[model samples]
Target: MTEDGGRRGRHETEEERADRMWGELIQEVRVAQTGVQILFGFLLTVVFQPKYDRLSHSDQVIYIVTVVLGACATGALVGPVSLHRLVSGFRVKPRAVRLASRMTFVGLLLLLATMTSALLLILRVATHAGFVPYLVAAVVAWYLLCWYALPLWARRRHPVRPGDRAPDLPPGGPGPGRRQGRT
Candidate 1:
């Protein structure tokens, strides 16, 4: 909430702000958690597949690294839930939120690594052509652009100033034709 009735418009105390931030953070975590969990699940099954025995030594190592990254990502993404549960009644939600945010960031990075490793292994198995490495590099560049570059550019270019109020949306939704009442 901000001073001007915009986006998350409303005046809120420090505690209220923390609460709202926590809710938003949790929503974001839920999305990342689902993705990492599913990826980790698939990685786990790979080791038991008959095709696992046929991978080259290098490919096998890549698979192992990917599995480890997936595990780390899963742990980090789920860490915030454990952290919140442990700290719930301590009157330190603001601090907890900060720590959880770090954990989420680490989780996202690990997910990126896991994805890159998985892609490398898949491409290696799918083709032995000389262009495979170049292809993987291109895809990694795209991931970097999409996952890290754009958000950072926006953050740097359009930062919220200390006293500036963000534009607010209507209560029902951001625009007209949104459901105005209970449906």
Candidate 2:
């Protein structure tokens, strides 16, 4: 604990870091879970609408697929909480965190697919023009850019070596201390 206080940059132990990460992950899940749940609920109601009966067979199929995707997205987004609950007190928090993170990523991907499908269905129903596919494709591209491409690009642009200290840490925050010359 050379002047900076403790081991890690934020002077946190392993458990402390895991705790912080879990908190952040939970907050993120809350936002995504709310969205997916709402979308799924709405999707569930669409079949009961009077207009649903007027849709062509192909459109009905698309609606069915979209609703299924929404349900899957909802499950994936809610998975992390279930994982945490089942694995609590198991003494494998780091591993649990990793698994939860993976679940969250999968959940986000599913959510993207659900959203794209829903948008495609909506656009098709709203307009029978030839531009619907192009429009949906453009929107999908935008979602990919926002969701994956930018984050990957930034990560590649600023690579961190294995032993490198965290950026958010201040100078002399936490690392091996320098040794003095022998007398």
Candidate 3:
């Protein structure tokens, strides 16, 4: 507890915090990895489709770019697992976790670009309408709002103060009305 009798931050050592964070990061990565891998696999088969040969040269270029971006996203999202395997038992969990988090963020950005380009190519081929660009832009804006804006807003609004307990945890102790039993 602090001098004012409020609960302190999570009672975890740096290593313990790193372990917890690594677990959480891996779970998040798993979700992204599945998505990117599926998208990448689909992109690979597109080139063999009968309709693919009929597409204009510019559309074909867009498809190629989208496929490349999807492959890059897949690599970045899966990099953390390989990193952990290579660094296991080296006593660098904290650093590994930070690097993994950065890779995941980059993966998300690549995934966004991949999806945006894929949508643009599909809409252009389907309708050949002048409004296709506007439609794609609207969808990208929605993705930004859902994936980035809301999270940043919440982080700024609920900045964690030093010595404050984790929000999900109870205020007093291990159990209701009981102080921590530590000596």
Candidate 4:
């Protein structure tokens, strides 16, 4: 323990860091899971609407693809919970967390596709306007920017390196905690 009552900042045990990271990942996954489940539920009922029959064949195909994507998103977003349940107390959380995070990422991507397709189908049916494809493309671009680009940028900006390359530790100065023998 240091004077600040903090564990040495640069030296977190693997399990300790994993524990903290897992908490953050779980919170993120919970938000995504809730969204996908709700969207899937709403989608499941849309096909039964009387208006559904009025849709063109192409729009109906889009609807089916969108619904499938939503179902897949729900499965993937909820995968972490099932993974945890199945692997509880197995001492494999770091690997499990990595896999779960990948599942969540896939789920989010699927959710993005589902949303774009659903929006395209709905907009085409509601207005039959000429600009529907352009509109959908714009929305998808926005989602990519918001969900992927920004986070990727942030991650690139602030990377974690070992003590030598790490931000807080200055480069090549006899490493950390060298005492100068001055007169």
* Least well predicted 10-residue stretch by lDDT in candidate 4: 174-183
Worst 10 residues of 2 by lDDT: 174-183
lDDT over C-alpha atoms for residue 167 of model 1: 28
Give me the candidate number with maximum lDDT: 3
Point to the candidate with the largest TM-score. 3
**Model 4 residue pairs with clashes:** none
Candidate 1 vs candidate 2: the TM-score winner is 2
TM-score for each candidate, following the candidate numbering: 0.81, 0.82, 0.84, 0.82
Summarize candidate 2's per-residue lDDT along 56-140 as a digit string, tens digits: 9988998999998888888888998998999899877766766777788888888999998898889999998789989999999
**Candidate 1 TM-score to native:** 0.81
**What tens-digit string does per-residue lDDT give for candidate 4 at 26-80?**
9998888888888889999999999999888999999999999999999898898
> Each candidate: how many clashes?
2, 0, 0, 0
- State each model's CA lDDT, in order: 0.78, 0.76, 0.81, 0.75
Q: Which pairs of residues collide in candidate 2?
A: none
User: Which runs of model 4 end up more than 4 angstroms from their true locations?
Assistant: 1-10, 164-183
List where candidate 2 sits over 4 angstroms from the true fold: 1-11, 165-183
Cα miss at 51, model 2 (Å)?
Answer: 1.1
Per-residue lDDT of 44 in model 4: 95
Full-model lDDT, candidate 1 = 0.78
Which 10 residues in a row give candidate 3 its minimum summed lDDT?
174-183
